[model samples]
Target: MNPRRTTRSSSTAKAPHRHPRHPHNPAGRGTGRLLAAVVAATACLGVYAVPAHAAPAATGTEPVVSRGVTIPAFYNPPARLPAADGALVRTEPLTLGLRLPGLDGRPIPGTATRLMYKSTDAGGLPVAVTGAYVEPSAAWKGGGPRPLVALASGTMGQGDQCAPSLALEHPLTIGNKTLSVGYDNLAVYRFLAAGAAVVVTDYAGLGSTDRLHTYVNRVDEGHALLDAARAAHRVAGASITEGSRVGLYGYSQGGGASAAAAELQPSYAPDVNLAGTYAGAPPADLTEVMKGIDGSALAGALGWSINGFAQTDPSLRAVVDAHINATGKAALADTSTMCVGDAILGYGFTNSKKWTADGKPIADIIAAEPKLQAVLAAQRIGRLKPAAPVRLATGIQDDIVGHKQARQLAVDWCRKGADVTYKAVILPNLGDKLLTNHLAPLLTDQGSAVSWLTDRLSGKPVTSNCWTMPVQP
Candidate 1:
């Protein structure tokens, strides 16, 4: 008999959701005055309270910083995008009154610009990607020219509405719905607070009118991220120079992008002066990660990869269409329009075996096909050498992306002569395991990652631990 494959599910498991980081804001004299006014008004009419500070709308044809344009196609390049990579195709000012997630009502103080820049896809074809360039309120008083960080956000679903640029304006926006919380915004705000200029890529095709996001496609993500850094310098009023020390920060999907950028920077974007990178819980090995998450709480991620591969790779698309059953096709179609929460809720604990015509799971089917295997292999990270020092953090007991694969990335990168610091957060308690697995590390490990990037930006030397460690077995 064939060896039985094991799978886990969170369908019946009950636990408090892992809470993301929230910005710290104090309610002072202004809040007190508002409360006093509300109390005074309770005597007659019970209707009134002061509204939170709202960000004003942008005046330009292409909005600088409103949620997003009504007709996004208007922003699209009329003709073919220029052949040059990292060229700034278009830019609009993002005003200072926008709100950061977790700190709603309080406007973010910074100069933010929405960018449309040229980048390459998996096919190496020129494409336009959307991004945001932000210069913090506090000037860069650091020793050298102002440091710039190319920040990539974690998975926010594959919809155009899930774009980080739109989320920056109204923190809770996802198309027409208002979820009121965005986990990645917290990290972006943290970078800005450190007085570093930030360039955040929505990644290729994510917020664009035509292309569907090639989620986790290494070349596409890396190209979009590096180009975001290059385009940041061209944004009007953005003082980032070519000489600025650049760093990379990302977790989950973003983590993969940052890691890819680090590897591809030498040849793809040699102009970027990379100092260091911090990648937290990157799904470095998609094959392993897919198998691990098949029946887990984050099973929905598998659907995302399927949808993405189908969109980007025609050979894989043919395989998927031929193999997927009616249920699977419907499931995949439904998820195309979903945001992160909907994805998790809609597909959590669902097994792929139910979606296939044959009894085998999707992974098994993919493994049996050479074309599918090759596509996945091509998307793998750790094969290429990153130009800068990289710090990778992961919870040892992670259930979603799997700790073994994440650890393997550190080992692989080290073998490739990368200056690697692999930090594993160890917590053995059952409650801790429940809370800290997978996504929780995104929030918990971010501070250390940020600090690591900070030291690099501050011109501190990075010492490699790869030589000291024993070889991976």
Candidate 2:
């Protein structure tokens, strides 16, 4: 559906789309204190918020509303697809929704360019991807040109309104009516404040008005991220150049996207040279990750993945449609229009067994269908060695994303002779399947993540820790 609106006057924005490598605050003590403060502040903001009004529609277009938030016109894609990947389809100024006072009186994080770019999906068909590109005002003192950090956001949800570009405008509008927290702002601003340019991808079909978001589909996510880099050069005022160094950053679902982009960079976008990568809590093995999320607080994510898989693969769709009950179908349709916050509010702690026609988990359903298994197997990351040093982190207590599968990504990469540094966040169980265990480490490791990546972007080199890592079984 197309959202019709006269362009609203733009506001200053520091894009909400960057990520870093470590959480140990290896950057400095001041940064560590700031990290804690940002977390606490966002934690407070990440709550049920009062509703806000969407700008009036200018012309006639099917306005897609997710949990009461209207998708903006900038997100609407043109009918024709560009033949070239990373082609700029459209661009506009974006205003971020950060109002933190006393942080040096900075009004916004950076200059945000709301952008729609061309990208190839897993099916090899050209598709439009929406995202934001921000040029930080700080000067680059890293002994080289300003670097570009293409950030893949952790699971925002399957909804168009959940797009990171939109979240930049409504980072904490979550409530009974709607919700989204650009929790990534900490990392995005961190890098921007340090004089790095940042680009955040909305992934294929997530923000664009063409199709449903292909959640965590490796090829789609990877291509969208890499293509964002190419598109950044197309955006006006973007300082990133063809020869600029690039780094990949993400956690959770974003972790999977960054990891996939690192591996695919060699074959898909060889011109985009990589510096380093930090993949935190990447769901490398969909099978294990799926089993873990089945009955968790974010169980609705299971529906999102299934919905995306079905939309991407018709063969898998036929098999999935056969097994899904009416309730399952309804749930998938509902989640297709919801952000992570909406999903949690609506379907927390739900079980997949209830969605299936039979009294078995969807994993069992997949086991019975070879087509489904093959498609899922093809989604696995770590099959290819990444071309840069990678810092892979996972929470030992995280049952939702599964620490083992995430660690296994490092294991496989290490075996492939990739420069891999694995950090297992050893936190006490903060209640299984409650997301606390899954997300606690994100903050704990974010400082180190950013520091590690910053070092790479600054021409710093890292020795591989693969010698201490074990190969996957």
Candidate 3:
């Protein structure tokens, strides 16, 4: 099966220079010196500083930017994965003085104030993966191992930008404030408030020295979620000695990752006690979703699919390389750092127009390609039974990812004897609203899912009271 449908854009080419979004001094005289003084002051105050000469690093190596910071490289593993058992493992408290290499393998200044965490894959080797940790506030007063919530974020494309700490610490600076939206952590916060430990994985390539995030790669996503738990245990200190109850939460691209993690966890990380999983508006059927959104306003999503899948399928890569032109290629590479507006600018207007120039729609081009179709078809979810309880939610009005797909997923899971708590809600007062179209379902589902997860973490028995009538097509 083709698995390259979610490959990330390569970071080798120099990103075209663009002016900084923030204002710069026009005097230009002591700008460099003034910047240096500000960096020093910020350093004293424990704030992160952008390296003066910082540029996106090349593939496979970390780029050193300043005194203690580096941009990390993406992880590109050989075809064969190391055996999972007997891997070297260690745990340590996340302290302010601690630092780990960024995605480019460069030393990134980390803060203990925020509770950073780290874990290594075992094989009797130094584990390289690292992640951020946030503990539940005192309001959560459980005595035993707190419930654990692991967040698998949706597509941020750029490895450097996907770091959760960066998202949490510098939300306004990031292109898509959505990653910084704290929806992932909102679930985490609720769970934590109910006495749960929350761990958010940076995914493989996003935070570690991996070259490209596997996007929705089932095996990789599962591994990252499991590993993040181990890291959280290390950072939160031994008081969380008992293994905590585990739950997964994700949305959109993250939904796909969380679903895959749930399916893979029983065998992948059997020791971790996975209690339940909540996935909202997941693209259970990638091929269908791609067809549904091609050349639409959400067409930018196609770039993520093409890049992600190409990593595993050479034929898919060749097709994309062959079909897209120079500008299209550049635009795809730029997509990782872009927000919705940038997406509209980069793909919606330019790339979409170029691909459809021959009076053929972009979707028609994608459909005409056999390898691309196979790659996407292989990415569908709902083919496996989760070891733990599962909750699925989707909006009745979702236009980007059709609501029909979410319903089908729940039906498929139930038919497979999986305990599925599914909900399809009609978003009121959003008459034909595009913004509400895709998100209303997700937001409604997210609210319910958070409440459900909190109940589970609090040791309440699982129930299906959340389910509603099957949405009419």
TM-score for each candidate, following the candidate numbering: 0.81, 0.88, 0.72
Residues 62-166 of candidate 2: C-alpha lDDT, one tens digit per residue = 455555566776676777878889999988888766534335554445778899999999988888999999888677789478899999999988777788887
Worst 10-residue lDDT window, candidate 1? 1-10
The lDDT per prediction is: 0.70, 0.79, 0.54
* Best candidate, TM-score: 2
What are the per-residue Cα lDDT tens digits for candidate 1 across 21-133?
A: 11221322332343243234322211211123222322432311111223243334435776678788887876432444334432355668888889888886788899888
RMSD of 2: 8.3
**Candidate 3 whole-model C-alpha lDDT, 0 to 1:** 0.54
lDDT-superior candidate, 1 or 2: 2
Put down candidate 3 lDDT per residue, 18-86, tens digits, no spaces.
313322323233323332332343343233434434455566544522111233333222333434431
Better of 1 and 2 by TM-score: 2
Q: Which stretches of model 2 miss by more than 4 angstroms?
A: 1-55, 99-108, 471-473
User: Between the candidate structures 2 and 3, which one is better when assessed by TM-score?
Assistant: 2
